[model samples]
Target: MRKTIIGLDLDRESSQISYYSERSMEPETVSIQENQDRYLIPTPSDLFTLIEGKVELGQMTLANFLKTCIGYIGPSVKPENVCIMITMKEITLAWADALRNACQMIGIPGEAVFLQTHRESFCCYTLNQKKELWIHRVALFEYEDTKISSYIMDIDYHTKPALVRAETGKSINLGRQGARSQEQWNEQRDARFLEMIEEVFQNDTFSAVFLIGDSFDKTWAVESLQYLWSNRRRRVYQGRNLYTKGACYAAMQRMDIGKRLDDFLYQSEDLVEHNLSMQMEHRGKQSTHMLINAGTNWFEAEYTCEFILDDTDEVVIYARSMMGGEAESYSIVLKNLPERPKRTTRLQMRLKFISQGRCKVTIRDLGFGEFYPASGKVWESVLEV
Candidate 1:
């Protein structure tokens, strides 16, 4: 089945989410004449204004825009059939909650939300056989909850080239210094990282893995996988491998969760059954009836049981003597007693019984246990028929 994929990028100031049908073409920018004065690179403030009232406009705000843009931009294609890009910088918990709610509201469903954190990395290449300029890009490091030591390294790749130039006025070779140094860091903490990745592989049913973000760091993630099983001599499965060849935002736009997202949202039958059992136990406890006034305080002596039967016929009284008092006594009486005196039925009846010091009384019917005040209060029926 075609999956509905939604990519969420949580930023410091504003958040961005990209939603598209799995079968539809990737969303692209269209040159609209409405605002030709606006720059190609839309400012964060402008994007914020556009998205504000537009959220209430429903998926049409995105779907209509994408349809219009794609129509205008013409038939643009990619090397890979899947992936969509989104850019945003909001990082508040409120935004996170809103994004989650919005996805549900849009009928996107839970299975389609593919969440990833972005990291910055660099790539050096010759543009048109001219000068070699370092391309600053964002890389996505897979968020493995089990990986304790692996840090999401978001190095400002743009600043790194300048810093390298300032430190050494000659050509700065990152492959020798930076990349090698990173490999060393990985060597020290590689085992723990593998354990984390392994835990995720075991726990989650992810069909395809999209290594989105910096193109250069993608190599590091792939290389690190080798280091993991090399020491242990275990083979890593390579069925689904997706490499995003663009910035974090660009890569997010092209990502697809496919059917995996759907599986993530729905619980297994076993889990549902277990939850149902727990609910039944909770409901049973709440519905079970118990006489609250039957129990007495800890300071009382021996208690009495007197059932005042009105016109209602045949009331079987079951009484139990509370254990663990000054007098260690516990009794269970299951007997049908005679009806009380005519006028005396309306008055409170005090059973003429006395003990040593303090005790408690427990009374029960067809339902559950009920404790009453042993000495302070007596059972009285105000109903006279």
Candidate 2:
């Protein structure tokens, strides 16, 4: 059976809901009333007429009209198929409790509720070394017949920094001060960001990770996260699949919310494993070599290589892929190596691949004229090479 997924973007002042229908491959938006007391509620029109000098209804008299509109729309929807999206700030213990009461009143099951928060950070800052305002955001999701769920909650304290001194006088320093000599303050801010991330992870078993925000530089946040997860050694929690993208574009592409959710949740494990194994093999094959795979499909285009011999005796590799016609790459360099007195040399390599099509990559060690393909899934070839 086809399922309906609803994506709700809720803000402090208003809310928007989008519903994706699989059969029609279309989305529909439902109108929501601003005030709660306008529709279906009883009001003595005679009393209002008496209060008003004119025969026409006044602005205050519209309260009952709005209530009637809500009442008419509320009964038409099936609570079981509804999914609610709300911001993290919108959700509170009280709101959850109130939602539960509302569900009970409507004969809807609380368990059917699902929540999601948008991952985008909306706050901004300047470059004058001044503190700005703190903006908090939360997004919640729920099915029509269930309780509310929060998808993402993010809080950002914005600040403007003094622009870096440059020959061109370009404003280089922007946004909040991420790292300072005062390590205590840095730690406090980092902890808050991590807490927000952990809250989303705790809410559901996320199949993908979407990084969203408006800041020009996210290196600090990403680095802090790397440090946070670097020491985590448990395999059960170690293997996580993440897909990062911008929030606005993701929303635009996710016309079918149900399909998007399903796709994110059930990505292929085999593909991930194959890519990782391919990287290990290529790194083990050569001291300094460049391997490029070019194709027409996302699964086919990939490039990876390593520079093993440098003055620093470090392994450097770059990899990238052209998935969906977008080229993305990453490079890593490692330093220091052992000499061959005991033939004990530490080997490391980095590789990057960008693909526009599906292609198989094979790495061969070329000793002047001879070539040998590294074989094995476990990456033992590093010691041999």
Candidate 3:
């Protein structure tokens, strides 16, 4: 059976769902109505409440919302064959856990679910496009509610695998609640948007510009649109489903279902910048064994394993940047360990990130089975990555 890749874009205002399979050439946004372009699904207020760390009594709003969104994918795609990537405006540790739990409640396995920020979603979408589109800098303007924010993505070709980073630019609120007439509001918004566009476009050579949100259209953004299209080389598009499609691409890349995106690495704000590893003897050969890899969300990076101490009283860990540089070594001296035969003391080590720049490692003495009883002692240390 062919696996199904699903991307669900979740936000406080609205959400979008898109899917891809072996048959489809590209990811298609799932609309509530068949044969229609209506893709935005209004998110329930209760879901937002839950995302804000407040869960009302007996309310399963998030699970219900997820079920409703995934229902549009049809019955042909089974839960087991589906891999989902959820993109949102902002993500926290609690929010990520809530989304995973919601997917779990809806019959989706936790490992089958993935989460990313909207910034990374934009990067994913851009990277999946033609080379010319993202070879230079790419610009994105997202108008949400009463504010418009700009994001610029650039690729550093100097890096071996190349580094893709998106920077958040200027943002301004286009207040129209007090406008007396639609014409006045449109004119004022166009002028302000034009100014913002000019300011951003002047700094870099953008190959493509994407306009997102329900409020952006030719009618209200006449002047800004004209200015953006002034450069014949720059391509412009308007859509609200970019995040959903980007999520789909992410899922596709993860499952290696279609196109493989192994060249460029997205360096998002929440990414763990260093790889945590240790030099150990594996199968009687000494080599560096990686415990945690870089380019993963700090909150989600963790590793645990058991190893026997071999003629060493100190544990050395190496942290290296993803951009390819010398590895920095950190050591923890086990001064209180019981003096036993070399390579006889068994130890269990666990590593977890406290933040993007900090990691906490805990090691416990397990002793050697019945010969040397457990010491019931633990050593902990925090490393600055």
**In order, what lDDT does every prediction score?**
0.28, 0.30, 0.86
Q: Model 2 Cα RMSD, Å? A: 25.0
The model with the greater lDDT, 1 or 3, is 3
Question: What is the full ranking by TM-score, best candidate first?
Answer: 3, 1, 2
Error of 1 at 363 (Å): 41
> What tens-digit string does per-residue lDDT give for candidate 1 at 59-173?
3344343333223322442212323332232222233334434444434443333222232111100111112111211111233222222111111334322321101011111
Compose the digit string of candidate 3's lDDT tens values, residues 163-274.
8998998899987649468888888899999999988878779999999987898888898899999989999999889999999999888887666777877887799989
Candidate 2, 1-385: lDDT as tens digits: 2323343443322333444444555444434544443211233445333323433343333333322322433565555544332222223333333333444444434443333223221111001002221112222222121112223323322312211110110111123544555455455445555555565555433222223222212343454356334533311111101101112222323333322322122111112112222223344563323344322112212344432233342322333431333333332222222232221232333222222222333332221112322222122112100
lDDT pick, better of 1 and 2: 2
User: In order, what is each prediction's RMSD in angstroms?
Assistant: 23.0, 25.0, 3.2
Residue 293 displacement in candidate 1 (angstroms): 36
How many clashes does each candidate structure show, in the order listed? 32, 65, 0
- Of models 1 and 3, which has the larger TM-score? 3
Query: Among these predicted structures, which one has the highest lDDT?
Result: 3
